[model samples]
Target: MFSPKSVSAALATHFGNALVSPAPSPLTDEERRMFSRLKILLTEKEQGLIESEEEDEEALVQESGDSDSDYDAEEDEKPEQRSRKPWTKELCDKMLEFYRSKDLEDGRRGASQSFKRMQNRFRAHMKTEYDLTLLRKYEKTGVIPSVRYSAMRQLASDVRAKLGEKMKKGVPIHDTDIRKIALDLNKLNAASGNFKASATWVSKWKVHHRIVSRKVTKFVTRKATKDREKVLKQIDELRIKFLAVVRKNPGIVIINADQTGQVKEMHSTRTLAEEGSKDVVVEIESKSATTHSVTVLPTIYLDGRQHPIVYVHLGEPTGSLPAKKAVYGNKNLVIGASKSHIMNREAAARYFKEVLFVQPMPKHMLLLLDSWSLFLNHSFIQGLVPKGHKVTILNIPKGGTSLAQPLDLCYNQQWKCVMRRLNDAILVHDIDFVLHTRDNLLRCISQVYWAFGAPMFKEYRKYGWYRGGFLTTHPAPFVTPPKYMFGEGSEADCPCSEPGLIRCPYCKKAHCFSCFVINSHRCA
Candidate 1:
């Protein structure tokens, strides 16, 4: 198969050229030390005598009379030099066992926890007998006990894989889990006098391996899901019914009412400080005495009108004070007194008679209410119903108040924020001024009404109705079962006499006692 030219070229090439030696490449000091370490390690391995990187380097440098040369140059450059140690299989197993034994009381994995006691015990055991010390770098890096990089890497990968597999199986991953695993592995391998890993090794591994921390959120409960469906269906039905009513009576008022409490405490308004100063102190009202608050019942209509704020102040009613005189000119704000500083059935009924009833209204009206016992009371319902007003007791789906209630959704928070700012201004002017005194507190609240009440209520109208939001479709009781149906029965005959007598705190239902006992534990 050979051509004549190829055969001639092969015959002309001399085979004796293969025997000629090439020039030797001289080894650098670094290369020489590395080769020397390799040689020592290999020999020691064969003889079943393990020698560490640090020990071998030291021996080689002493033998070469170049202790200060490039042999130790690498260690000198580092902030801290790593001293490798030999680890036995026994030591590695012990570390793993120790970590496995350590667990938090709540059953969370505590293997990677860097407690002082854990580190001290490890250090003591290593030094007392083995004449070895664990480096801070190794403690942070989560390096396994073995001096060999390949072995340590494999061990780390195994532990990480186990953690990943646990997570896949629905086990919650804590930030400390990885550290615990590394610490346990290190402890187990300590008997062999091997270099253990550093605490931050897992952090590096997470970044390099693309591991990310994710927030754990609670899954939607079955009851919440059912409530949502029911609420949506009810809202649609109410929209149809309400729209029809609106067509019949164009001026029929649609109002949502709820009661919230506000304490007579001041928050920060403004601070005078230099631009660069990180810390600035604005004195807030300290709890030197028991703080008292007034229950505020605010109502907003679909047509952007806010009824007078009903401030239920604690203590008996004394005639008009300076605060009452200041607000008497407006005639829009009202204050009432309650023994407990909370709105009761009497207070609510009085509010309807004095504030809501007096407000300009059409023959027909819609009253939106929550599942409060006072709102669902017999007297409250009778007073509103006989007067020919529609009552739609909105059964705010469980955990749906923020979404369903117009006041809770945005208005109250903004109102409170504004009130706090006002209170802060008052306190800044006079720190010794007491806001809990009836006159001063009422004055502050009256100011809040003047500053924020009108504008905030206007914004509430937009959020609740104009757009395709929660209020676009009315939240009627058609598809959803209401907690209490107004005018259904007399509540006075009941033993508890309160509408919330049969209410379950756990499942948030107002029903018969037998029903409450059965479903009261927790909703499915």
Candidate 2:
């Protein structure tokens, strides 16, 4: 046996000093080129020598260990090894074929178990020399080709297409569609039966198709032209009646009354514009204060005029003299207390004594004031009405004055005009002039009056009377006049004898007696 070191020394001696040289550095260019080429050839030769030496060592080990006796022992062991059964390529092929066929009756029951056993043995053998992973490529291509699965999927797709086409063409219909069609046909048959059962029996006409051809008819009822015309005429009559009623009572007056404190320090101012200018503005101002000692009850009448009257009454522990004197000194208007104001006889007497000093007792004057506690519940009427004069109290609903009262209408209109005037005034004189001139106050009063008076105008129009005429003339004073009058007189004295009267219904007169009397009375 040759030792590695001895073999290397012998080879080195045979090759000489040329075989082993010191590594070069900073060689000439030509020497560098030559050395590079020789290095590559020497590396290949060294590799070949190393492989040959390994082969020789293996051969020597085998030769020295195995002799005739060892060969005989190995031969005797080979039979036992053969009996142990090593897996061969033929065995693998046969096992794979049985697995692929799935022939269990042919004695390959546990194919997966047999496959695992074969894989282990083959992998052990391959690991001794080559890698077993290389068999994975062969298994993929030959044993389990992916194209077979793809082919099966393509066959299923073709079957589905054929079935879909058959379904579309109304051949081989689905069970559900067939059931639906049967049910529909059955319904049709039932309908036909119902028609046949109700149909009249005619000997000559036995045409079933003709009867089936008839569709269900829907009867639509329509109004006749004559009926429509009648309805239209009725509607027109109703419209005319409605119009007549509206014309008869064209306007309505809503009244609202609320009271405020005394309008303190009332004053007015006049303004002059440029010489040729048409504008002349007036301003007014007033102030008020609140006090707990004296309760000033203001009665605001919202009819044809927005007049707010104030009455001061000393409340709680205050004597009648102080209250009465205070009210009298503050305002010209005075009201007397009645028995109703008395909580007791003493209070009644005291109230009477104090109030009587300013005004006579039992004067029934209707105060058109707002609905306040002082004005409501007939407090004012009971307190002020004289013993003999009958006081009739009227209360307007809340917020209704704008619609029912003459004063609210007038006030609204006047206020609107005043606002416009104030705006114009401000534009001309600047903001400071508004405060100094008291234009805002004047505008407010004007607006209130306009709002109150508008309702009166509307009422006048509705009643075929002029508001201006009534206001200026002061007809009937505080009371409304009666609609009719009658008197006994001879034809000569009676106004009915005049030529203007033409057989009046009430008097059977040929002359206009009522008109003549009305005109005369008004003039007087």
Candidate 3:
């Protein structure tokens, strides 16, 4: 409801509109855009006012016989929306074929065709395939918009010529590009086309744009996206910081630790890295039934064996930690579960104070942490640092955690796959122990991670750091998780010499389904 004077004054103050200000004769891009916006707003307001006032009253006016612009008349007067026509490779080629043939017939070299010819040829070509416009409409429907078809035909002809030149230049065309053109062309003398691009479509259509896309029918949803600039910047920053730390102290431990939420069931092979991100999407199942979760924090070193992993779940501790004594476990795991079942500030602080700081390690070390607020909070971490140790914290940039963190780079996906395989075994063999139970879940997570501390995984985990640009050379090769746990590569036999169903991660022994599941893989 702004008056013309008020709008002018606002534009003069904000956009420096030359009409209202004594700046200059010529306006800048901002001023021009503001003026254009003002014009559109004023025109829309005036038109709206007229429609509101005259909607109920119709004056007896004489017919001048000048209204043949898209004329259709019925009782309701609501014209059916036009169907969208995607320009496929074959269709585009056909259009160009007609253009070339017509050019040759006219003996015109590289000359644009006339609007009438173009319009007639396009109409005939569309009719041969399917004329969506000619479909029967409901009775009592009428075309409302008064647009000159001759003008629209001229514009379509111009667009066709422009696209033809692009085809000649060998630039690839996409349906989306054609859709944008179609939408823009329809805008002038426009008719709303039934092109539905919903948010659900965008979210589910998870293929990367460059990798290629698939369409369900004629709809073309845009491919999922990635922030390349952020990824590149994070990589560069990590490389610089890591090399600097290594140069300063050649023996500093480079550790990448990440806390991931493990679903109640591990049927889906999708890792936590791919959970929220649209990058590198693959369809997975068992993702929806996560009623309970366990937080698993794994610390992988760039050079040495990893420390015992910490498992956190959702509940208050029933017993207090003995202040003077250490918590003992044969599985070499540290377990805790706060009420939240997430890596909260208290859990982060506890991890440093117990599992990390107490581990036998060098005095100097470099730790890579994701930019979680609690991990970065000074008050939370200040008391957790050990007195004699030099812990340099490198904050992995936001959204760049996957690109920089060693656990996220590759190891975590493999870790989840192992967990999934475990779930599969339990389900297939009908194991007595319910992994859904908190204690059993903790035990399963511990056993998988404890196996990682073995000699085979020591060198295997270094590859993640190497891949993340921390290590100069690749580490020595090791067996993959699938081969080791599933006996995919080499043959393995149980004590009875029957074909082994699964391998015990801790005891380094193979067992049959009866022994693995029924006997709880008793290797201890």
Candidate 4:
């Protein structure tokens, strides 16, 4: 435990000459604040010392009070007899006049003009010459600085208000504008000259103040917007009319077709890395021209039916390609090739006649597609007229496929995502595997079709054709199809080996028609 002596020694060491000597007189504004705090500390610590000093003063005051109490009481009774003068309107007006005189000098409206000159003049004139106690007190009101500070603060606030207005108007505030604001603030404050208004500083300020700087992303042109609106309105009107026609026709079908490109090696969408590491390099398989791509055409019926995907590969189609005709009469998915690897008019016509037309053609069909030149020819339209099916080609708005076309918006993304995953898995598992090889490529494309099509059918059911009332049946050739079948029905029961004969439409599984009708819609 520390004795009182030790505590005193410690206090003495801390306070030093401040304890022994009196505080300096006529203190400046800052010093006066320190003096007041010191007085409080002394009052708490040295109460005994203060009582000793006040003893003589208290005795003298007591004696004087005995005689002067009655006189003082009388003076208090008449309040008007007070020595100090109260601040009258006349005195306030005089001080205002002095301030305004300087304020008006050279048209100085901003707070950058010094208020100290007027303050000093007011104090000197009132104290020495007039000898009038206008305020009747000697306390720091900080009136001049307070007024000037408010003015300076208003300048910054105005800047903020202007910035808010600009943002609301969608006018971007650049770095130069921020610098100008800072410069204005410096000018508004009489004391400060140099202010940091660097672009980095402005960025920090914006974030700290919760002022978001959002970049404007450009999308559709004005003309494109108008065209899209016009096209969509037309589609909506025609779709309603088409539904009315479909109510009478049971075999009517709504179909959407779009093409997507598949790359051999897909770049990683996301990857794992240590925090704060910058340069991350992930090595991929050896680059080849074949890694570029191949085109695929995916067709979907509103009844949630997806046709076998037609792959358009580079170079000529060879014997290595999957056979056109399976053991069954129906043709399999037509995998064709061209020099450019794109479906030309001939390929497009073949796809229409071979794969699409080979299926049971609906009585009245609506084919929703993008504005591809291959499907717009007179020959293509005339060919459909001869068939019992009335095929209507409704073109989706140009540059609006991503938004309007269900195939482009939904199936294409899902297809590519599945293909990417499969390709990545294959590359990771068997490093030597070449995806562009005939068998591997065929297998990969086939997996993309079947794997993506199953789950996709469910989504289409919920979102597409059935909801739109395009077809009466649920179109579950994949679901209701049988797993096994008797082949050419011989005495020795033989399972069907024909590819097209035993394929489920919904899930794309191998099942015969009898099993499909009996089991009916076996999902996945």
Candidate 5:
């Protein structure tokens, strides 16, 4: 048996050297017992280690050298013995023949899933063993030519013959017609395992010819000078009417209203002389500046008031929004901006809260506007109108705003006044701010006066007169000067001399003359 202090020191020397040594403590009863047990276990293990091998040093070295020699021999034999898979002509022919024999249930017989799987397997196997250079050479030399071409040849030729017959009958071959013909040929090839290459070539030729014909037609159809001017004038008139309506109804939102600002390039001539030339060579060069075009759409609310609702569209167009222009080019000429409807819907809600609903309420706001798709839809309008406010939407008849809206009549006058004011402001203040400020003020005043003043105030005044409401003999407080006198009687009639001759006190109607009162006494 070992002493506890000697055993602890020996254990520290063997195992605790790898770790930080703990502070020395005097052994209590439990600590003394645990240290005694650990000492016994350590002594037993140490005796076993001392009794074991220090005898096989030469044998271990000889065993490691033999293992290394065996590993080298295995490495040397691996390349020669490894199997290599090659894509031969036999594999390509077998795959092609299988597809040719198989009658696919689906119309897509040529590129069936089974056929694709086989093709993919072939490609993968080839890629693993062969270089891309070998594959390209095989494809070019027809050693492993794609069977898809041979399968499509006869059908292509048949389609070409049909198209040629149609052409001989004076039927113009359109791109769509050519595409349909090509598709038909492809389907035939899939079914019959053969298509003519000539059909593909003929279809392409027809498409090219059709495009050339269209270009020639477009060039020939250039409007005469007078007709062009007339069209331009019409466009100007439409623009003027459009602006007028927009001014009257600020609620009528037009996206991309700002014109594209592009400056024209200036061309100058320069003289050039060659060293051996008798006469100086003159070259005409014209540099045209690039002009960017922005598409502008004038939209109006079909209904004057916005509803309290919104709509979200998912997926492609159905019938909700119609195509504006005919598809003429290679790609679809989608006129409206991508996500414009979403943006416009957002703008409508913003404008309604920020501008329209900001005003004092209970007044019926009649918004006169056009019927553009963006505004005509109920979802957009619903989001615009505030709750509990009376919003009346008045949609102007299609193409009739010029004759109907007062703003149209007033635009030229307003524009002239604006231009004059701008000139005056520029001269007096030497600032452009005046023009914007004054123009905005004028437009605001004009719109307010025209829409509200004329229809509500002026019309109500006339209505009141017809209903025998209090007729003003003298200028009323609210009514402007040149006071409205609403009576059959003239100024010569005296109320005192002929009290009965005077009209009723309440409405001042001569029909109810018996109710006339002067100085708080009823007429007798």
Candidate 6:
């Protein structure tokens, strides 16, 4: 590939100088090095390996003028930018990869991620992107580890085939699962001791195989499958009825309420780390956190108003708080309890009698709720309400919550995102507060819900109403809270005065990754 005109002329000058020297004269070091280079050029030119014009003895004499220094300077660098410490570790960030990003989502990641993070603070690493690019080149040349280019191609092919076979068998495919197979194949191919599956390589394999990450949350029943058209008809009917109710009481309070179990650990799967960094470690309060559960019923008001979540824990909601943070015991959430760590009929009835019934609620209202077993008991509910209060209950149809419920559109996901971020922050900062405990979970949920109800999330509320077939007008200029939260939309700095780069899902204010994780992140 070295066919520069200057380089060809420089080589001719070296040969001419050597020929003109006295007979039997020993060659100088420079002349000897130039002759070696000249010989390589001649051999390649004859083999048609280079595109440069062929030069004979006369041509060498005619093309003289350039010096050896100019020849060395004019030579283009080799395709490899700089030698990397051969990829010796496993995992995506540090491993060799070949991700072909075609779509905006993937392409935005570029050849590498944009930011670098450390345990203490955010540090800017300028050459990481360049390293990522070089890693790709090394992968192509079979200079990475000991496996050749042909062997890698075969490994990819084998992994893809294995994925298909597993999918056909109804087995789940996880990101780590891909690495497991690659490691096995690497051993089979006799790869060097440094071989590790690059996270990027897995991504490239995913892209090439048309695979994407997905959560499995739903299943089809035989009866539903057989009566698919009937099910569709039913869904349409439910939507029509729900929209009618919305139209009927335009000014009345319409509350969409449902309960969900909180992720015991509450850690986010995503995090910011130094690009090309291996083994990002995230710690949590305890593994037992995932074993216990707390129930929360978050509601979305029609007018983007705030509401206290009704949270439940086992026994009574009681626990000790740090002396410095005793405000956690305040009325941020309506806390209740049950023997099974959820609201049962008895626990719910008691909560209604002691907490909800005592509130000065609107005289006339409509409640949109799911068909929880307890909610289906009309007699029990009617007996608890005051005689004059006009609280109409409209139960969301069975299996209709997925489509007909307003909060399901996005608000629930956003709420969870807030908690996930906070939970991870707790672990990252090593806060002593055990979040899964009844008292601490109550306090955190209260803080999160307070943030969640902010006016910044008004669009999220409107989005749920609009997408769930309840809104007559378009809620334009709104964004999905979860996706938007991941962006650098915050205009302020973190409490620590760093430039904000990530927005709080609930507060919609940006904070640098360090402040968000290390410092206590709360609504300002």
lDDT of 4 at 94: 63
Better of 5 and 6 by TM-score: 6
Task: Give the alpha-carbon lDDT of every model.
Answer: 0.45, 0.29, 0.53, 0.46, 0.33, 0.54
lDDT: worst 10-residue window of model 5:
55-64
Name model 2 segments beyond 4 Å from true. 1-370, 386-390, 431-524
lDDT of 6: 0.54
Question: Using Cα atoms with residue i matched to residue i, what is each candidate's TM-score against the true structure?
Answer: 0.39, 0.20, 0.49, 0.42, 0.21, 0.49
lDDT score, candidate 4, position 121: 66
Report the C-alpha displacement of residue 79, candidate 3, in angstroms: 79
- lDDT per residue (tens digit) for residues 173-292 in model 3: 233223333334444424443322122222221121111232222222212125556556876977898788889887787777888877777653222121233343322224543544
How far off is residue 370 in model 4, in Å?
A: 1.6
Give residue 398's lDDT in candidate 3 (0 to 100).
71
After superposing all C-alphas onto the true structure, candidate 3 shows an RMSD in angstroms of 23.1
Write model 5 residue lDDT over 280-397, tens digit each, in one string.
3222111222111111111112221122111111111242333674321111012222232233554444445543455454334544444445545645665667776555443434
Q: What is the lDDT of residue 395 in candidate 1?
A: 38
What is the Å distance of residue 157 in model 2 from its true position? 91
RMSD of each: 30.5, 54.4, 23.1, 38.0, 39.5, 26.7
- List candidate 3 segments past 4 Å from native: 1-227, 269-289, 315-331, 489-492, 496-499, 504-508, 513-524
Model 3 TM-score is 0.49
Residue pairs in candidate 6 whose N, alpha carbon or C atoms collide under 3 angstroms: 92-199, 490-510
Between candidates 3 and 5, the TM-score winner: 3
lDDT for predicted candidate 3 compared with the true structure: 0.53
Compared with the true structure, what per-residue lDDT tens digits does model 1 show for residues 317-352? 452234534422224456666556666666777777
lDDT for each residue of candidate 4 in 339-453, tens digit (9 for 90 to 100):
5566677677767776566656666777777778866564675584545667766665565564457666456655665444344433322234555554455555654465445
Indicate whether candidate 1 or candidate 6 has the larger TM-score: 6
